[model samples]
Target chain A: MKFTCDTKELSRACNTVSRAAATKASIPALEGIKIDIKGKEVRLCGYNLELGITTMLESKGDSEEDGSVVLDAKMLCNIVKKLPNALTTIQADKKSTVTIKSGDSEFQLVYIPADKFPELPKIDEKSAISIPQAVFKEMIQQTIFAVADDAAKPIYTGALFKVEDGGLTMVGVDGYRLAKCHESIDYHGQPFDCVVPKKALLEISSLLDESGDKAVDISIGLRHAAFMIGNYEIFTRLLEGEFLDYEGAIPKSHATEIKVDVRTLVESVNRVALVVSEHLRSPIKMHVGNGQIGLSCATSIGAASDTLDANISGDDLLIGFNHKYLSDALRNAGCDEVRLQLNGPLSPMVVLPNSGDSFVFLVLPVRLKAG
Target chain B: MKFTCDTKELSRACNTVSRAAATKASIPALEGIKIDIKGKEVRLCGYNLELGITTMLESKGDSEEDGSVVLDAKMLCNIVKKLPNALTTIQADKKSTVTIKSGDSEFQLVYIPADKFPELPKIDEKSAISIPQAVFKEMIQQTIFAVADDAAKPIYTGALFKVEDGGLTMVGVDGYRLAKCHESIDYHGQPFDCVVPKKALLEISSLLDESGDKAVDISIGLRHAAFMIGNYEIFTRLLEGEFLDYEGAIPKSHATEIKVDVRTLVESVNRVALVVSEHLRSPIKMHVGNGQIGLSCATSIGAASDTLDANISGDDLLIGFNHKYLSDALRNAGCDEVRLQLNGPLSPMVVLPNSGDSFVFLVLPVRLKAG
Candidate 1:
């Protein structure tokens, strides 16, 4: 088997698909990226059992015969990136070795048989709904960070996607902090919903080109989902678990509220965190006074305190929370000012963007010990 | 300490001396930087027992001080770096806490007793000799990379600073690679010789100013060496052991010589090393053919090979050596063209700059198994 293609195209395609390649594969062949050359097109496939990524590239003006080979993804990437030439010629020898030559440098790499490569899963695309890439990317970025990283809790490890008469809502909670983003998509054509695993969503998000003008088409089924963008297609196995009713869990109203600058709050938390003990859950206490904001953290190792002038008008209240949650929420809130809704001490608080209704963040307050 | 200074100046000073601050100190007081605010000057000192760093800021310009305090170096650096203004006031309260205020942000840091801070050792100014900072910095950079990081052998962790007969030579070896540099320096009417620890030389190298006109006055005694660069003084304890006689270790002549481009050799080694096994030292076989260079690394996992065109006159020879050493020599050899002087397999090869003098690098070839 013999094939030739542009060095840049091959490198870019392999890199994009190889993100799903298993680092420690139970099946040795799964560690490689499968390459198939048919007529004038080259298809690359990589998978990790749970998810599969496949990308195709056509010859730029020139056509070649059909061929197939499975090359080590890492070695191929390193070699292609370093070779200095526009056109790279790759020819397979005996189906056991692949020869690559660019300019004056040549390399012969061993290849595993293409028969051992895993088969790409099939998805029913009849009920697909097209969505703008920017809308989906923003929703994922705004909510994915709140997903629980632990696999012991299967439901929390995946973002709950609910589609109903109102809109589509994405909700993630790790028990301490929760992030929710709601968007109205063109879903009337075919009502669909699935709880996509955080890892799968991350892979799909990385595959989208933020600068491209193309729209992404997403299709969901009973136990599977497919995302299509340009010539790349991703298939993920939907999680099989019951999602929490996040709307009922969130607080409906608050008695006291304080508006604070998002940037100033994030910076204050970062500074106070420097002196806070790393092992203990970093609980920063917020004391809201007449026209003032006070932040403090005390641990066995050390203590730090800072105050920021603000236009706050309410009864003085004190609350303790994980500094990291507050920092993360403010950093990704995409708002100039954030409203801190307080129910009472020991109760959960809601932080919302002052000017937008699309995103809302919630944090569970930690109860301080009796003085 | 009670003083107000420009945040940028204090930040730069803290950054420069904080490298010597101990992260995990047996003596708790040593973890803090000693700040003495006298009538007209404020002195900051950080020590980890073996080395001490002292920097001074006089009150003649903008800083006004009249007291002293010792604060944790790590915490002070973090607070100063995060504060959001140019002028921050530091004051010692009656409760022994230092208050740092900038704009509306305030941080109260606990301070250790100033009396517990270690005292800086005094150096005899009569024995100090001045050397241009550029020459000193360059000599250290060219030799320190080869020093043995292994602390089991005490002497190997230091670079031999030999001063005799109006010349200074710095030699370092890690058993596999040797870097030696020599330059003539006036001894200021007195001769001295000593071997400074590798860590100390690296620290001094970083402290040297980029301005070419400035010079560092250095003094060497039986147990301590001090470097005075402007208002900063660094004192390091000497390693009490005999250094290796590198003069006898470097071979005098060679059986084959070849000249090659430094950049080309470095790039090829990096590419071929991708397949070299990690546990087994990365040994790349070099075959100097007629006007061509062939490099290959074969392992049980995989094999990678590349050949580049070079101007060569030596007879056909194959030598195996650690690719890292070759890459390092080529990267730091300061010359565009390097002439490799090889003795034979299992013997060390000398990498000399084409300009003929000032520096030399030696790399030992890996003993290959019989084919």
Candidate 2:
């Protein structure tokens, strides 16, 4: 394609599409970003089968010849990034090679034939539902970390999204711990439930931060989901499986309760875990009694213990848990003080922010072998 | 040992020794830091055979007894790093296990026997020479980058130091590029020529900063070199081989000369090199003539060209060079404008700072094959 565009606009479009371009894809054309110019706008698209990103820029008081070429994203970016800030003009010769010219410099880069590019599934923009960008990003941060990375359990590989008449709840569980959060939204009575892959959510979160004063338009299709933020649109295949019933796994009662300073508890547990064996099961015991809570990790090689004075009540008891699972939950809770409810040493413990139970973190305690 | 010391002092000592302790060493003892207590001071030592560091801290107004033990550097550092600001006490029991008590936390860590710790070599203080910390650090930086990394050339793996009555000069070469710098020292009549290992010079440079108030004492023994800076001492073995005669490699005359702004030249060539084939014998060709320099790189697939104005005084000439070697020298030349001296397309070109030849960088040009 022959076009003269602002360097900033070109650079931003290249960066957004390059994220979906796989560095080591078996298909050679997948490594190239497809560029197409038709009416008054130019569009760039990149796809790796699993994920795709497409972005467009409209001409400002200008018009260019309608043409298309698929240039290597990596080499084009390197050249544009190194050139001094200025307007850049790119043109395709009769031989089908692209030339980028700026100041006294000219670069000829080979391009893959645009016809070889895979066809991207068309997304209907009219069926989209818009949500506040801030709320959407926060929900992903709150629940995405708990998603299991192992693909053996396909359902747990993605975050479960449940949307009803009033609100939306997102839940993620990795067998050891579970994180769940809910956000109220203004929507019609369109009810839906789907599991969105963690990879798609992660990429969406990275680009959402820059969408200030703008909303994220999300559309759910029969088999694919699309998120449109700013000039960029990201699409991915919807996960096909049933998620676990996380509500049935959360504990309801407790035998001992303690309220602790969130920062103090997280730092103490992380320090003690440094000496814990990585191969063996990680079990850190917490003794709640009187007016204090004691955190302890005992191993065959060594032991570490830290005591924090807190407001603890109920029966005196000791509970063991996976150190990482508890820390992740406490950090994500986002509260000054957190109240931990323990039923017994063998049951899962419920960790709740002092303010409310809207965000709950549940950790399955490790069973300490009887001496 | 039972002693309470300032947290900052203990942390600094631990960090200095931990640098020498490699986590992937075959010998387990080498992974631990040896802590010895005697008189009013506590000394910590860590080594990995190739290099070693020792740091000492004297006890302030604290209650304690005397003992010796070796603790895992990585583990101890992790615990001490997380502790809040306060003095910490380390106590050893009859069972020989150590307890670190900081604030409300206590960590019991297993230690290797002190007798198994390797002993650091002793260098005579009489064979020492004192130099300004800033000057010594600068000398190492000017030459260390040119040292060859290939194990095949044992002599080129170190910086050659030529010390005489007038002053001292250091030179290093990696077959393609050479860097040499000279500094005035306080050495007397006796002259000494030795090759200091590149690893040792790098450590010494990082340890010594631009503080004219302090001095770095270098003691050259028969087998090892020791550098004592403040309360820390570092030891490294010297390379046992003769360095190449660098003087013969430097050209006595030139056929063409050009003076250009260092920043502009480096940036332009760097951009053009992006399109050049990496690790290839012929990377880029420079055509220098009347007041303008043109750089071009062409592969079987594509080509890029750029031109920049320069102050030229000689006839037109063309030279081929590995773009990376030229870029490295230009980046580290530390000058606003550089004067390039060239003999021919086959001879090495010398790049020097515009003012004087205090620092010299020479790059051997690549020989182009006939078309």
Off by over 4 Å in 2: A58-63, A124-127, A210-213, B124-127, B211-213, B277-282
Query: In model 1, which regions exceed 4 Å deviation?
Result: A59-65, A164-166, A280-282, A313-316, B58-67, B93-96, B124-127, B188-191, B280-282
Per-model TM-score (chain A alone): 0.93, 0.93
lDDT of each: 0.80, 0.82
Clashing pairs in 2: none
TM-score of 1: 0.93
CA shift of B225, model 2, Å: 1.3
Candidate 1 lDDT over B185-206, as tens digits, reads 7774566567788888888998
**Clash-forming residue pairs, model 1:** none
Candidate 1, B289: how far from true, in Å? Answer: 3.1
Model 2 C-alpha lDDT per residue in residues A200-275, reported as the tens digit of each score: 8998998896457678988877677899988889998778887878999988788888888999999989877876
Q: List TM-scores for all candidates, in order.
A: 0.93, 0.95
lDDT at A99, model 1? 77
